[model samples]
Target: MNLDPALRAILVCPQCRGDLTDDEAAGGESGLVCPACRLRYAVSDDGIPDMLVDDAQPLG
Candidate 1:
């Protein structure tokens, strides 16, 4: 399923509440990152955010 644009517009990183942008660089799997916290949240298959720190895999 595609991500909800409205939800994406308002979504922020849970750790820092910083603005998030589409992580197209990480393949089609969408993700958001907080520059301040250097934390990234991955979008689940169901379009829900997996905002756990452990869930974020380090960028290669």
Candidate 2:
């Protein structure tokens, strides 16, 4: 699912409250990565972002 530009501009990481950038791969799965927290929040199948901190994946 494609994220809306307007929504992306305002969505922040729940852990550090930092800006999130799209880290979508060529295969079509999408994630929102927070540079400050080094966490990746997964985007749901229906296009909704799962921004919950507990659900975030750790970034290497």
Candidate 3:
């Protein structure tokens, strides 16, 4: 999870436009979590965030 802090600050859930948190310690594969929606947006190996709601998984 090498995401830049500046970029992370501006990211929000595509579903609800909610704040996201780094889920490196979260269950399942690491991702950025939107607690309000219980969705986890996957982060690629190169540190790119997949913000697509269609591909987001349920937060564990």
Candidate 4:
């Protein structure tokens, strides 16, 4: 799902409260990534981002 530019600009990491960036290298599995906490947040097929902390995937 493609994320909205406006939403992406304001969306922060649920764990570290740091800025997030879209990582195209995630092979479409990870939509947003928090560099500070090394977490990847997934996006639904409906274009909604799952920003929940518990649902975040750890970055390798």
Candidate 5:
């Protein structure tokens, strides 16, 4: 699913409340990565972002 640029622009990390950037290789899946927190927020096939902090995976 293609994420809208505008929506991505407004998205922030739930943990650090920092900026999120597209990370296709995140945890071997598509996701948004928070540089500050080093976490990966999953983006579902339908284009829904899982912004929950607890569900985020650690970035390599």
Candidate 6:
């Protein structure tokens, strides 16, 4: 599925408050990442962002 460009334009990393990118290969499966904080947030089944701190996984 094509990602919403508007969503991409607004989304920021919850941890670092930095810009976010659509990692298509990692999209849905691994969610989004904050390059600055190295945090990974899970994307919901409905494509909503689950931005809770506890839900974020440490980057590799």
Task: Put the candidates in TM-score order, highest first.
Answer: 3, 5, 2, 4, 6, 1
Best by lDDT: 3
Candidate 2 global lDDT = 0.84
- Across 1-60, the per-residue lDDT of candidate 1 in tens digits comes to 357888888888776677876675436776777776766677777788777777775544
- Please list the residue runs of candidate 1 whose C-alpha ends up more than 4 Å from where it truly belongs after superposition: 25-27, 58-60
lDDT of 3 by residue, 1-60 (tens): 877778888999998998888887545455899999998888976778999999988855
- TM-score for all predictions? 0.67, 0.81, 0.83, 0.80, 0.82, 0.71
Cα deviation at 35, candidate 5, in Å, is 1.0
Worst 10 residues of 6 by lDDT: 21-30
The best-first sequence of candidates by lDDT reads: 3, 2, 5, 4, 1, 6
Candidate 6 C-alpha lDDT tens digits along 1-60: 243568867889876789765554444373777888877777765677777878888777
Weakest 10 consecutive residues of candidate 2 by summed lDDT: 1-10
lDDT by residue for model 5 (16-60), tens: 788888888725567998998999888887778999989999876
Higher TM-score: candidate 4 or 5?
Answer: 5
**Candidate 3 CA-lDDT value:** 0.85
lDDT of 4 at 40: 83
Residue pairs whose backbone atoms clash in candidate 3: none
For candidate 4, lDDT tens digit of each residue in 1-60?
477778877889988888888865545564788998998888876668999989888888
Better structure of 2 and 5 per lDDT: 2
Model 6, CA-based lDDT: 0.70
Clashing pairs in 6: none
The model with the greatest TM-score is: 3
Can you tell me which runs of candidate 3 are displaced by over 4 Å?
A: 25-28
Model 2 TM-score (2 dp): 0.81
